[model samples]
Target: MPALDDLSLLIEAARRSGEIATSFTGKTAQRWDKPDDAGPVTEADLAVNAMLHQTLTAARPDYGWLSEESDDGTRRLGQRDLFIVDPIDGTRSFIEGSDTWSHSLAIARDGRITAAVVFLPMLDRLYAAAAGAGATLNGQSISVSDIATLPEATVLATKPVMEMQHWTKGDPGFKRAHRPSLAYRLGLVGQGRFDGMVTLRKSWEWDIAAGALIVTEAGGQCTDRTGQPLRFNNPDPRLNGVVAGGDAVHAALLSGLAQTQATP
Candidate 1:
């Protein structure tokens, strides 16, 4: 199918996922820990995941599947196309009654994301993109900020990423902000709400896949913290890290990251 056709599917799937997720919000749906300390997962997450999995895979049974709430296996590795999803990208925030959480969905073909959507139902924000088609939010085109320099950039990052030792010379001094959802941070960058975003910790493919495509299609650049281009559906299904921004800002973040001793 054409990437845009796939994008249409993703957009609809994301909306349904959002509805399933939000139904459990403000009221307790069961929550618990994963065996590997991978963070929390609630009943809402599973419900959304199940709906997305059944609806999407049934529509494209030839494609593979990888989801945060599902068991991981090598089956996805054999397919040329597959779904990479995080039914609820910010379970903790959802559990805490925060509205910033999102449902992230993407279709990866031959290791590249071709169609993607990140939806925050509570906020009514929907960011969507198809490879080579640019990006949009709520049906309006969006682009990255024009800021070119690091000092003038307003970046989204966790507090630990701002520590002095993470920079080669010293603090780069860009204003730092944060969001509980990695997908949301990337969406904000794509929407031009922030100049950039950084996460030096190893990131999950399901978490970053959709957002990465949205940022790039919006005229921003996205890569691993080491400045490598991102490739999805790997055997491990995890990335070294993520750094995304407008052209100049992305370069600056990579240069600073290279000087640090950190490894993701």
Candidate 2:
């Protein structure tokens, strides 16, 4: 199928999943965490997972599946194309009544993402992208911020990671803040609302896959803090961390990350 065909499918499934998610937001739902302490998963997450699995699988059984709420089997490793998903990217935000949660979905072939869609139900905004095609918000095209440096740049990052201790040169003095949703944080960077986003903990593929593509397609860059490209559908679907921003800033940010992560 064409890239747009895959994109269309992702957008449809994301919107449908977003609708299902909205229904359970204000209502009560069962919630729990994995024995491994991965994070919380609510009834809404499972419901959306099932709906999206059915929606995508029924249309493309040959495609493999990788989902936050589903079992991670070895089957996906052999498929040429697969779906990477987070039923709801920000369960914490969603449970807290924050509107930043999202339904993040993407299609990856080989090791690269080809199509993606992120839907924020409460905000009524949809972000979508197809390989070699520009990104869009709702229906209009979007791009990363033009800001070329970090001084006073609006950034999304965990407090400690953004601290002066990590910056060897001195704190970049970013206008930093925390965003509960990883996907939404990335989406914000893609929308030019944030100059950059960073994290220093392990990041799941399902959490960053869609957002990575969206950020890149928006004329920004995304990769592990060590300056490595993110590849999906691997036996291990997690990354050490991610840093994303427009070209010049992204390069500079990586240098800071290198110093921060460097051993004393």
Q: Per model, how many backbone clashes are there?
A: 0, 0
Model 1 Cα lDDT, one tens digit per residue, 1-264: 599999999999998988788778544779998887889989999899899999999999999999999999998899999999999998999999999999999999999999999999999999999999999999999999999899899999999898887888679779999999999999999999999999888899999999999999999999988888999999988898899999999999888774443354
How many pairs of residues in model 2 come into backbone collision?
0
lDDT to native, each model: 0.92, 0.87
Residue-level lDDT for 143 in candidate 1: 99
For model 1, the superposed segments whose C-alpha errors exceed 4 Å read: 259-264
Cα deviation of 19 in candidate 2 (Å)? 1.3
- TM-score, per-candidate, Cα-based: 0.97, 0.95
lDDT of 2 by residue, 232-255 (tens): 888988886888988867887888
What is the Cα-based lDDT of residue 40 in candidate 1? 90
